[model samples]
Target chain A: MHVGIVTQTYQAKIYVTLRPSVLDPAGTAVQTGFKQLGYDNVGPIRIGKYIELTVSADDEDAASQQVDRMCDQLLANPVIENYRFDLQLAPTAGAAK
Target chain B: MHVGIVTQTYQAKIYVTLRPSVLDPAGTAVQTGFKQLGYDNVGPIRIGKYIELTVSADDEDAASQQVDRMCDQLLANPVIENYRFDLQLAPTAGAAK
Candidate 1:
């Protein structure tokens, strides 16, 4: 069986945020905490998404397209949060090539 | 055109680790950091994956199956690290139903 695992590799991303309009106490707390820690140079505490995922396709083009669709159809709530990410490809290990 | 972001929202998981045998300086640093924070009740700080995603499909079953395949073919590295996640579905906004 071709057992495998999916992570922040391949064709995806992980998004996090403060549920819409909900007070971001964590973000505010962190900002205050940072100030106390002597890092007063930070900008407005815009706490938002943390995205991670991996993609698999016959090639990169199709993977990108499908992943884009997946994102639109599901992953992110376009109204509230913003996201960023990194991509990586993991080569198969100990497998007959 | 429909545009979206595929985060750790649906049909996915994010697998993270210290890059296979690479010393986890951050994890070690965090463990120590936590101890200094007076949280001596913490464990070995086995830090790993953080996943968030959203899935949309005709329904749930097909999405789950396809996501499983996507993961096996790409998202994760079976050789190292560990994975976990959460799934949610976002309804269309400001659209005629």
Candidate 2:
């Protein structure tokens, strides 16, 4: 008897943000822009990166681990930033590709 | 009797991404970096912006509306990007200020 192992595709949405102690000049600039545009009620904006990608793996745990490694290696700078991600099973169309 | 209208504070996390049809050079560059670092399994990476800010409003709906307006006015580029946001009640520490 022959068995087949099908790899599942997971979609990951990763958010990388600066550590609270880090200064965010871009965010501060945007806050100033908001005030100039009459959005005076807006307060204390901090900016970060949002990344979306797909990974094919044997299971959800494997996919999550791979994503974590990727973040540590390249997606985020640990000294100045932190990252969190959400993973979902990719749609059938995406999996087929 | 004085009727008090205390404004509630909401924290908003906004994501702005390029439309699928638009080309993303930065994403492609990052993908190449991932491949060079031996993460060849990664696929179709896209990079975007994540913004966190606080808004003071009368209620949840009011907060949502204000955020949507902010996105249209200054946070996102309507021509080639799409935006979405999640709103939560600010913590007691944040709301107190």
Candidate 3:
């Protein structure tokens, strides 16, 4: 593994969520916690997964396409989970704060 | 157990991360994937969890304190994980896009 070097790449953030029609037990449990806390005005909650990845691609469109492939193949379950992403130029290692 | 009612509340987003000293196998695994994909310039990768919730609070400070307490109590493991959050006056339910 290489270290201490920065390279130009694409940064992708993928959010995976259950289909709206599907029940999210964990989300309901959190909402219940709010209910018990007397946050009666609090709204619906959905628990989902967020993934950040860096990949080699020429441009945003290319990076997004690759990320979509990755999501479809392994990152998200198409049967119940839907995924969307945002992309930007990758920052150097240790640059994020 | 009410549904379809939009209310004014505080929206909180919590990001939980492993301490810098802690080894993150999942993150390493993803880094390896990038290595195999020839993204040698791709930098360090860290994987963490993101959580969102709505709560009743008089203001942002109140909402943040409640979220901090929740993080300390049950939302995150203070021993090896660090947590931070962002808060905003909540938009109506289903307003997120």
Candidate 4:
């Protein structure tokens, strides 16, 4: 027997980064800090941001599908940044998001 | 033969996420979006942030050391979030960060 009273919920996490061809001023600053610390071997770096989404969907595939669309439409700038995400299901409402 | 004029630089990327015990309002909003979209199976989610650094260090260990300190002191709130980082060396300055 299936319980139709409640549906499944999922959690999604996304990571976004600047494209290799772009500049990262923040990353450069971090490099400079290492130099000042006398550890002058740090390499060039790129900076990025992360986003997490809590969604109600039929399943993982559907949740991923919706979030992917979200990423394409507003989360990442395809011309300058690249992104990846992960999704997991939650069985309880106590899992705060 | 060695040139003391320049030091090696390393690129660092860090991901910061809240502890399971913490609350995430931003993630919750994402979940509600799914509910409104008619896909009421999405679960609770956790939100986090990312950071990247271009550092000049003597070696990977050294860069990691300094960055670890930076995370502890500024990048993450240990009481609510956890962090991890990755580092790579670059041979040329053209690798913008």
Q: In DockQ terms, which candidate is top?
A: 2
Per-residue lDDT tens digits of candidate 3, residues B1-97? 9656343477887778788898888878876776686546444566776677787665567767877887787667899999888988776533532
lDDT minimum window of 10 residues, candidate 2 chain B: B88-97
Which has the greatest lDDT? 2
Q: TM-scores of all models?
A: 0.35, 0.92, 0.70, 0.63
lDDT of 2 by residue, A1-97 (tens): 8747667789999999999999999999999999998877888999999999998887889999999999999999999999999999888524633
TM-score of chain B of 3: 0.81
Model 3 / residue A48 / CA error / Å = 1.4
- Per-residue lDDT over A1-97 for candidate 3, one digit per residue giving the tens place of the 0 to 100 score: 8655333477887777788898889888877886686556556677777677677655567767777877787667999989888988876533432
Which digits, one per residue and each the tens of the lDDT, describe model 4 over residues B2-93? 85544456767788888888888777876576567654544565667787666666566876888898788766889999999887774564
- Report the candidate with higher lDDT, 1 versus 2: 2
What's the residue-level lDDT of A77 in candidate 1? 61
* Least well predicted 10-residue stretch by lDDT in candidate 3 chain A: A88-97
Tell me candidate 4's interface RMSD: 4.5
After TM-score superposition, the amount by which residue A62's alpha carbon in candidate 3 deviates from its true location, in angstroms, is: 1.2
lDDT score for residue B63 of model 3: 67
Error of 3 at B87 (Å): 2.2
Docking class of 1: incorrect
The per-model lDDT (C-alpha) reads: 0.44, 0.90, 0.72, 0.71
Better of 1 and 4 by DockQ: 4
Q: What pairs collide in candidate 3? A: none
Better candidate by TM-score, 2 or 4: 2
